[model samples]
Each structure stands twice: as structure tokens, then as C-alpha cells.
Target: MTVHVLEPACDWRAADVADETRWTLELSPADIAELEAALACAKARAADLLDVTRDDFPLPSLAPRLVEIEAQLIDGCGFARIRGLPVERYSDDDAALIYWGIGMHLGKPWPQNKHGHLLGDVTDHGKSGADSTSRGYELGGVALPYHSDGSDLVGLMCLRKAMSGGISTVANALAIHNELVRTRPDLAALLYEPQPYDYRGEEPKGGEPFYSMPVFTEHAGRLFVRYIRPYIEASQRHPDAPRLHPKAREAFDLVDAVCADPAFNVYMDLEPGDMQFVNNYHVLHARTAYEDWPERNRKRHLKRLWLETARLTDRPEKFRNFSSHWAQKRTKSELKLDA
Candidate 1:
């Protein structure tokens, strides 16, 4: 396969964003008022969080800003942070509505897991990272390696901050890919080959426990990435899964090494009411291990959304069908909120 190279539209480095101002968009008082009014309108109409639509939660003043944020995710920096919501003034339910409503303006909600939850809770659920079937979001107090998620865009709205640590970091995968091609074309080529990934016990009935997808894909002149090392490593537990090639292992290591470099990553501590949105194809994100309050009510919690953006027109065929089977067969039980 030929190595595809393109102009750096979204390529950025840590030094490019030395201050939080680069990625942050603090909402104005009018913006907050508009959002609150929208929420009030939705509540008056008896709209459930799951049932609320962009039309239902109209953001007249804030809609333009949301548009700009979406553009930044697709074309500028691959990530954007919107802060300054009065999270303390609202109940958990109301805050969730505001978040969900804002997300609706960005993109259509995509299911996060096999349960087909368009909206997901990101709090510790007493899961062990050592377990082959455990997903990173299910485990608490563990640092996550930089990796892309299974969506065009992924968003997290922080409802509560951790007691300590849990700082969020993002690395520019686009820049890393370009650097790899310039420095190590051999290693970069291997990333285009299919790699086995574990389904994390969410495999469809009668389907293989593992699926194959390339770490990097080039389609219609755009670079798309989907990397999750833990899932790839976990695939080894399945007897039928293909063994990882030695070259593929080297490629994985190289990608991780590049991502871990301080020059490539930007770290930020998410405060309550801060909403972060990232382009899954261009940015790889991680979080430092955190300590949560012992009291359940005081624990760190963030709401998550996987989105399919309108801006991203063409993608690899595998991505469209990435989790289509499970999504089609999803039941009401899978849509229920676990938290």
C-alpha cells in the first residue's frame, strides 16, 4: 500500500496551543441565558433527555458559537472546549439536558457501546482494567493511554471534577502520522494493514469475538485513524483471533512513543460544566489516573456522546459498519442508563 500524505489542515502540536485560551471558548452571560431559556422551554414541553431534539432546545444566541466549535473540530485544531456553564445552579438532570441539547446542535448522537446508548455515563463502575473485557471508561482511577474512539466526534461534558488527578490530555494524531511518514515510512505502512481488535464481550451473537480494522486509513484524500491498544492486546485472549504481526507490534510501539512525547501532547484539567469535543480521526485523547471521593454522590462523573458529524462526508467502508450489527440488534435494556 502506498503511504498517503496530505496538507496539515488540522495538524497541531502542544507548542501551538501553549495556553488554554487556544482551545477554550468561555461562554458569555448571554450565551448562558439563551441556553437556560432553551432548557426551560424543553422542560415546559415535557421533553425527556433522550427525546430532546435541536428543534426542541433552540439556542438562538449560542447556536452560532456551536457552529464555530464544530468547524474547529473538523478543520482547525481537532478539539475545542466550551466552559462557563452554571452547573451548580442546576440539578444533575437539568445539567444533562443542557449538555445533550448542545450536543444535538453539533451532530447526530451515535451509540457508545453495544447497549446502543446514544448518551453514556463516564463514571467508575468498579471494573478492573486488568480484565480483558474491561473498557477504559468502566475502570476508575486508572490512567488511560492515548487512543482514538469509534466515532467521527466524541464529546465529554464534565459534571463533577475528580478529587485529584484525572487531568485530560490530547495528542494530534494527524501530526504524529505526518511525522511518522517523514521519519519512518516503513513503520507507518504497517499501520494501514488490518489489525485484530477485541469486541470486549460485546460481540454480536454468532459473530467472531474479534474484528479486524486498520490503525490508519486514507480515503478520499482524508486521513482517518482508529487506535485502541488495549482492545488490540486483549484480542490475544481469543484462540481464534489472528496473532499480531511483529511489524504491527513495532508500529504500535512507535505510535505510542510519539504520542507520549511532551512536545506532542496538551494537558488540561476539566472543570465542572466544561464540555470538550474532539475529532476522533485527528486527535487521540487520554486521562491521568484520578482519586474520587468515597461518597458515591461526590465521585467524578462526566456524560459522553459519540457523534457522526455532517462535515466528515466520506470514510472507510469498515467505519460505517464498525458496530452496525450490534447497533441494529440493540434492545431497550441497552439504552437504559447504568448510572
Candidate 2:
């Protein structure tokens, strides 16, 4: 949905990842029906707003219904298993096209994956090497180490898959927080403190090349966590970030352990055309890397989305980029596209 008015004043506040518990809402006939209607409405509305044509875009009418599904994904039951969308019926690049359309109804598009990014399996550099964007390479290949990108929610729509070894994994951030707060309050306290983060050049013009916020925050009794340790650690490269206390390091380690726990996570094998979205602030997601047998033509490719669902929720004071005083409050400035 188009933001009615730009929220005046750039608060530049980012909210903490809240500790709201998430439950899987299974896909049902009723849910599918609702989603179809919403998607159809959102498509028409979005196309109209963009001043696009029905024939060129091939959009279905799905706005109101899309908003309903988006609300459910954000605030109601956490995550849902949705089915019967066009995504479930196709493969190849066109399936990726459908995902971009559905995502518009769900949340604001992300910067780097603005509108959408091609979710194809190609030989990108593994942890041991650099990234390659070759077509027919492993796109969305599983076995990737656990990590989260900058998005309120991530929608993954399956278009094709590797013959084997591409299971998706997700860990609940709340579970990790609860365990730490109960067993390691001292460490948890550090997470609650402001932490310095590398801007990665997303800062506003004239702003410093970095910002500070905590890995976790709490507001209205909800726990919110946002962690990309690699980025956090990179901030140290600036020579200005505060030194992490020994206790703080331990807390980070503890949180990592919880995320690795099988008990607090779920595994998914995305089917052709199935779209799955997870709350980035509440979930830590990863994939099992796979070896693609290119000779057989079985490859992995999926479309990805970074969404911002305006779920009127409270977060810890430390999360300022999304809703904090430290963040730019303009909702948007230049639409960086690279984010």
C-alpha cells in the first residue's frame, strides 16, 4: 500500500526485534481463498497507482485481500503456510515474475532487492570465495550459513530447485532471547545496550559512515532483536565503535548457540512456486549449501523480497533506524535502491 503521507521528520529510529512468540499458521482452504482475493485486489490497485496496463503487467485484482494477508503475516500468527497462488504452478524465470507482483501487496520493497532481485541458483562465491552472478549457477542453493539480511520480512518464492540438498532453516529470535535473559542476564544486559553498527554506506548525506544500536531491544514488554554479526564486527574497522566488553561478547555467543539449536528452529524444503516469508526481526534464517549437478540441468533459483510491513508495534529503545530518534524519519529520502 502507498504510504498515505510521508511521516514528517526523519526520526531515523530503528526498532528492536521484539520477543513476540510466533506460531505456524498452516495453509488451509479458507486461508487460500482469502489470499487469492487479497492478491487480486492488490495487483489492480498497485498497477493503477503505478499507471500500468492490465495486458502488459497481466496483474490480477488483489489489493484489499493482499493487505489482509500481509497483516496476518506481520501481527497475527507470525508465519503462515500459504498455497494455491500462481507461484505454486510454475517454474523458470516467469515464476519469479509472479513473486514480484505478490510482494508489492505485502510490504515496501527493499533497497538492494528493490522491486525484486533475480533469485536464481548460480555459482556465487561461497564463504571461501567471492560472489559470481552467472546464470544457471546455484541461486538459492541451500547449505548457506545462517544469516539475516536487512528487511522487515523476506519472501522466498520457489521457481526451481536442485535435485537434492536445499532445505531451508529458521530459528526463532524470541526463544534465543528468553534463554539468555533467564540464564545469562548479564550478557543479555549487554545486548540491551546501544551497539555500534557499520553503515555500509546507507547513511544519509553528511551523516557519518556508521551508526550505533543494540543487537536487541525491548518495548511494550516485547523483545526485538536485529543481528548481522559480520556487519557489527565490521563496524570495528571504523576505529570509532566502542569496544565490546568481554561480557558482551559472551552474550553474543550465547545467542548464536540458541539459534543453532534444532529445538528452536524449523526446516523447510520449498516446493516449486511456493512462497514463504519470515519476519526478519523475529527469525534467523539460513540454508544448507548444495552441490549443483549442472550436467542434469537441475538448478536452484528463487525470487527474494525485503518488505516493510507497517505493523503498529512497539520495540526497544535501542532499535532506532526503523522507529528510533536516531533514524531518518522521512520514510524515504532518495529510495536508495542499492539497500
| Residues 1-339 of candidate 1: C-alpha lDDT, one tens digit per residue | 667565487777888878888778898898899999999988887646777878989998888888988988888889999999989888777888899899989998877777777778788878898776788778889899999988889999888888999999999999999999889999889898889999998888889999999888888888889999989989999999999988888889989998999989888899999999999989999999999888877788888888888787777876662446656632212212214
How do the residues 49-83 of candidate 2 rate in per-residue lDDT, one tens digit apiece? 22222232332335555566667555543344434
Off by over 4 Å in 2: 1-72, 84-93, 113-143, 200-209, 295-298, 313-339
Once model 2 is optimally superposed onto the true structure by TM-score, how far is the C-alpha of residue 248 displaced, in angstroms?
2.1
- What TM-score, over all chains together, does every model reach? 0.95, 0.65
